[model samples]
Target: MFVKLHFEEWIKNEPGVSENTKELIDEAIICYRAQAYRAAYLFSFLSFQNLLKERMLVASCPPGYDEEYWKGIQSELRNDDKWEAKIIECVERERPAQIFNLSVDTKRQYLYWKDRRNDCAHAKSNKIGVSHVESFWLFFESNLSKFGVGGGKEALLEKLKVFLNPAFTPVDSDPTSIIKEIPLTVDSADYLEVIENVYELTTVDIFGPMKTRVWDEMFKLRGEFLDQLVEFIKTNQSLYTQLLKEDPSKVRFFANDPAFIRSLWYEMKMDFRTYKVIIGLLRHNLIPREELNEMISTVSSNNNDTFFFQVEEPDLLVLEESGFFSEFKTLAFVDMKINDFNWARENRNIIWHLIIRNGFDETIVEALNNTMSNSFIPWRLRDSILELFEEFPKLKEEYIDVNSRINGCLPDKLFNSN
Candidate 1:
């Protein structure tokens, strides 16, 4: 069956989209129909790139940057070396923090999609699957509305409409519907029923035992369900508090599910309301600290490299206070790259404590040595290293002598002390 008619129309008529871009989308549809999934992805990616470039070029140029100057920059984007850099520059310039609600993790995901598009275009060994294409499409669709780029809200609503069952309206569209279905008084049975329904949606495999058209629809439904649940909790705060007091596990499902947790973190990374909910749960001992640690472990094991680091600053502090840092330190220092090492150095007290308490593990020592040897390493890290050396005097002389020879002098602290 065709993906969805309204979605196709939405993409076709998306403002600022060119006729040539429409042709690329049409080709993508044709390839998808033929089961040429890779080709379909490539064409869709091309359409997405063209539309993005056009939008960026129009919106991002500085007031003083005349049409001729804009044309010169646009021309440079056609070059292989210049394309990604130019796009990043445009995005940074136009969609600064106030305008774009994207988090560090989301921005990284965007760059990753761009890299995947390059793989598709340049015949890289990386396989382009249906899931990858779906991810790219979903990200673009959501952000289009998020950034308010040319009727994005209407476009998003139209797209969401395609996935929704005609008989059932989205919860956000009809507030009274949820109130009727979910019940006003919060009995245990009602709470359990609501939790069960939301859990099923969160855990459902989109590609298994379901038609392709239902996939996007289910995702939208789950999101709407979450919104309704959050609202219900807010409206009946006393009831939720009572229920949570009786059984915190009811709310723990959000933290327990890695996919759900990551999605929530990314979507509301900037919002305090969600953080309040999580912190409340933590304070009430609803979600065990060990559970949070396990969640981080699970995410790490699943190869989600950035989720933990992307946690908002306040939440990061909460996680640290809850003993998540012990678990974090195990992973952070192992093969620590410069960026991560620097991050650790910023939290030097925690890192130093973990190092000293754990005792001089060879891996950490090696990582420190590597950090010290890099001439470009930040002096803060070097100072931290020297402090670390002071704590473990046995390794101090050896490291000092070696580092001194490498850098031609001791770090200022040691050099001046003498």
Candidate 2:
């Protein structure tokens, strides 16, 4: 809820705060304010569960385990039916002595509040009063430092004062005031710092009207901003590479507008890294379908097969899901060479359905004919072609002559028949 603005960026930026946990806290705050005490208690308890799981994950894993490794642990915890037991097991095995540096009394209070939360969550007829909600808030307030809030309890109370008072004005409300101070022609490093600062200052209200004027202004300056960003990426290769390796989605703000994304795609020289950025944009639907098709067409026409294949290979499902059937067909048939038979066979199941669904039967027939006539085509691939024809009886009529020509031979005897 908008009232609890203090927790917005704090929860989002905390390494221990999973998105699910943040969402639970958001729901809990909304329900608590709405006087839906039972639902509020349940959501708060669920958030506590997530918090414990995150702590366990952090405490159990050694240092230098990358973001992806932590993500895997988080995902496993989410999917595990006995996650509570798993957390307990992790705590016992890992022996995490301290959690956010709470005093013993505060920890006891947290446990007591957790028990009350459980009672209200599990009992259908349990009545949760405002006292219980206030008690939980007290527990939460006492442990503010554990979640990485600075200035200790005084800062927590100060933020709470703003939450409780309607007329309280915060300096962060209009981030544009800060953004405007940064010159349009600032150096790349300074520009990146400004972008990061903007991201940190902006917060989305989960249950209220969207306020994105800061981001809107940034997007309006996409040409200048993206040019600087691309330059920064080029100049600072290691930092940019690290950001991508850790979390490529961090740069998704550039992909929020399709026209800007198209401009970015055109302005930057194509490379493996640029291709990955474009793929991330496409996955996020930041680039329009038509723009994506055009980009793919241009890449293929330029004989940039390596870039084309790199873009299409990992993102075939993304392309299909985005309904880029034309792009999918182009990637499937245009640049694919006979030497890529093993790659084709590896994804034959998905490719087969895609071909049939997109009405590329004629293309497959021609490819099969070419494969059969060309002696340079591997015998194993020749057998694969026959298998494809047999799988689709409708294509049998078209490829019957080619199949007969490659039917019985010394090669057929050497290789197993499909």
Tens-digit lDDT track for model 2 on 160-186? 334323366543454343233232113
Candidate 2's clash total is 0
Point out the worst 10-residue segment of candidate 1 by lDDT: 177-186
Q: What's the lDDT for all of these models?
A: 0.50, 0.50
- In model 1, pairs of residues that clash are none
Error of 2 at 53 (Å): 21
Candidate 2 worst ten-residue window by lDDT: 202-211
**342-373, model 1: which lDDT tens digit per residue?**
45444454454455445544455555566555
RMSD of 2: 18.3
Model 2 C-alpha lDDT versus the unseen true structure: 0.50
